[model samples]
Target: MSKLTGTTLAALAVTVLSALPAAAAPEHHGDDGLNWSACQGQVDPRQQCASVTVPLDYNDPDGQQITLAISRIPAAESGLRHGVLLTVPGGPGGSGLNLPSSAAKRLPPSVRDRFDLVGFDPRGAGRSTPVSCGLDHADLAMVNLRPWPAADGSIDGNIATERRIAETCARNGGPVLRSISSANEARDIDRIRQALGERRLSAWATSYGTYPGAVYATMFPRHTDRIVLDSNDDPDPSRVGRGWLAAFDQGAEDRFPDFAKWASAPDNPDRVADTPEQVRPLFLDLAARLDHSPLPWPGANPAELNGNVLRETMLESLYADARFPDLARLMLAGLGRRPLPAPVLPPEQALQNTTAVSVATLCNDVSWPSDPTGYAEDVAADRAAHPLTAGLPVNVMPCAFWPFKPAEPPVRVTDRGPANVLLAQNLRDPATPYRGALKLRAAFGDRARMVTFDSGGHDAYLANGNACGDAAVTDFLVTGRRPAEDVFCPAD
Candidate 1:
């Protein structure tokens, strides 16, 4: 399917229905009570945290168990409370522990009043007894973390790195790491619902969270209430993460114009070019020059302005409009127009855990073909077609060298689920582009309605998305209202 759609790149990468079907409802985990208490740190007065134990492998329900860290802020109006609205974070590895507090602030009063905002650090993340592959510091660098072939497109180094990382993960990432996957996440969510004693759950899922959310809806259709899948991702079960990595090629093309326009705007103090048209060429030329003659960047982690670092910066900066200046400043530094800013990196342990969980999820959720020659061919073709990404999108990741086959085939999303899902996506999301979101929308069929915003960036909800898109989602969550058909929110 990916080969045909030309969107598969490699492993680098809900509705209320109480009435419809009881058998499809979330599995009944016996009444295990949640003992919510004040969360650690300077949390909002209302924020509370609790932990739930779930099987390390659902297949062996009576086997070893792992704990999930959960947080919540009770609904503003208890009398009007509908149920739990889980805030599913991005990064198959992101911690959702703080999401409820932040999300509660963005949600409209009506929505906030009716739902207990909930968040959780998915198993193996954050406060949930984290696991790590204990990767080397150099290996943790962004350029190395994301597969970028040699300037000439030789993937020998990337292939080697993939093997080493995969082996390291297998050696160090215990059963907890092996347990991290989309299927398990959905199961964990069901456990959360059962613990919460809510037969149906409403969710606001973002980025990669959209995948598990969709999977949960597919696997347990009647278990969901009002579902809002934000910053949607492609739900193609076969390729899974591989297709997401491939979408980066088109995603970069779609999003770069926004950065270019911002960089060259007349009023912009850090203008990279006089006009938007010049910005693209200027960036390409700069990247090429750096590829050959790199610049010294002392404060930066790798301490150099190489082509891959610049490309990584571009990818990171495209996540939000406010981040455009970060890319511009880096570009300026590379051009010798300014000094490089100090790069702020997460703690080493944090990076290791995140990388481990992320790679594990992508690789474990589905299998990536282990053929290096096939990747070589794909990389060459992708390079010719989308030089901005320089074949990085289609390049191999640790998944290629993954030691284990998928425990189960990826979940195939279909229209058999409840028709309560509302998808809101940015037309030009760099991480998850419109084309991929369209695939997810199509998979949902009449079961879902997509509200696309004529915007550029990764997330499309309250952040990055305009008022139109925000209103559409807010309406769905607060009032169970969706447009008669899919709607497009014009750029603001």
Candidate 2:
């Protein structure tokens, strides 16, 4: 059950407003307490912006406040409008401020016509009163951001990095940083719903967003109208982020073959091998070669092309099939067959904020074992079982040294919620694997039904262009209907 407090209610009531231009505030809408304004930058003209203030600490609601930036596109047909359909973004740090515009372009007209698409940058992200741990440039690299063990499988270096990161976050992240958690984010969502005067909210939540969406459903079942959890996460309250991280092992194993098939196609320009069977060994050999003889790559973080760098690139490329060529090209470069691509580094502040929010949420959401020995044992076992990920998934993260214990236990997603959720998943999602999606399905039990696509990739909505999965989800959102049981969408 949700552990709401009197202070939480007070925090929801505090109105710390956004500082948008005076010309942009919503005019002539007396019903909306929000002063909607034209969003800045090259955003869709239809997207209007606003902000809400929620307590920095729900337990001490009146003590401090933070703003949550929001955006929306009103229903095209107001006469037939049902209610607000919120879009919950992934990353735990990803901004949802532009979700309305994107969803407007993708969702079927029937669904779009019936509701206002709502989106928000969760507390401590994007324009929502952001926070940062102030990480150094060296630690901002993708290879370093993810905990990759040393070449010899010794976690000594990883331990030092985690400890340093944890110390940095503790020293720099203020109250809002410590307050970043799924539970608090859900509360912030509820505050948004209340501010909109909507009795209930329908949501299309993807990736890491699925966790808080499930938590919201569990916490306030009646407040949820309809929910679509896409690219689902395991709702295991016991392990939380640890389990999500560890799933990367199986996730990589599950998705690599798809990339291999694409890379090894006979006519493919980026072919790394003549046969799919040879692609795996070729990759392993290339990574091993890089590990032994690292190359000095200018402009790349750590300024080197090493085994972990290739592995990190591979992990990132597996997110979408369109990115397969990038990984294949990198493999060719590692084999002295091509040149290295230019790196794209995010601004220092953005990277810092993203890292802080992601790490803070993970560490604050649940407790991870502090002992390095346990992690070492798990890493060794995972490396043996799933060599593709090299036990990186089971490795220790900054969470191991996080200063604060969870404010409360991670919310247990139970079968207690209303039967309003429909989950859409890709069978071979590299980040949230099919098995993890099943676990989420099992946790929701009769409260939810799932549509699994026999496809490989991270996202499974309009992204994959799979008609079956998209149609099922659209039908559910357009009409309050779902398949009575779990269904499979065959590969197209």
Q: CA lDDT of 457 in candidate 1? A: 86
Listing every candidate in turn, what is its Cα RMSD in Å to the true structure after a full C-alpha superposition?
A: 4.4, 6.7
After superposing all C-alphas onto the true structure, candidate 2 shows an RMSD in angstroms of 6.7
| Runs off by more than 4 Å, candidate 1 | 1-32
Candidate 2 backbone collisions, by pair: 24-37, 26-36
Name the regions of candidate 2 deviating beyond 4 angstroms. Answer: 1-30
How well is each residue in 295-358 modelled by candidate 1, as lDDT tens digits? 8877666878899898888888888889899989989998989988887887888778778888
How do the residues 1-492 of candidate 2 rate in per-residue lDDT, one tens digit apiece? 000000010112222222222112122223768989999777779899999989888778797888999999998897778788899988868778998988898888888888889999988889999999988888877766788888777788889888998999999998889888888888899999888878778899988888888888777676778889999888778887778887888888999999989998989999999888999989888887888899888988879899999888888889899999989998998888989888667788877877888888888888889999999998888878887788788888888898898887767676775677899999999998899899989988888899998888887888888899889888888777778788899988
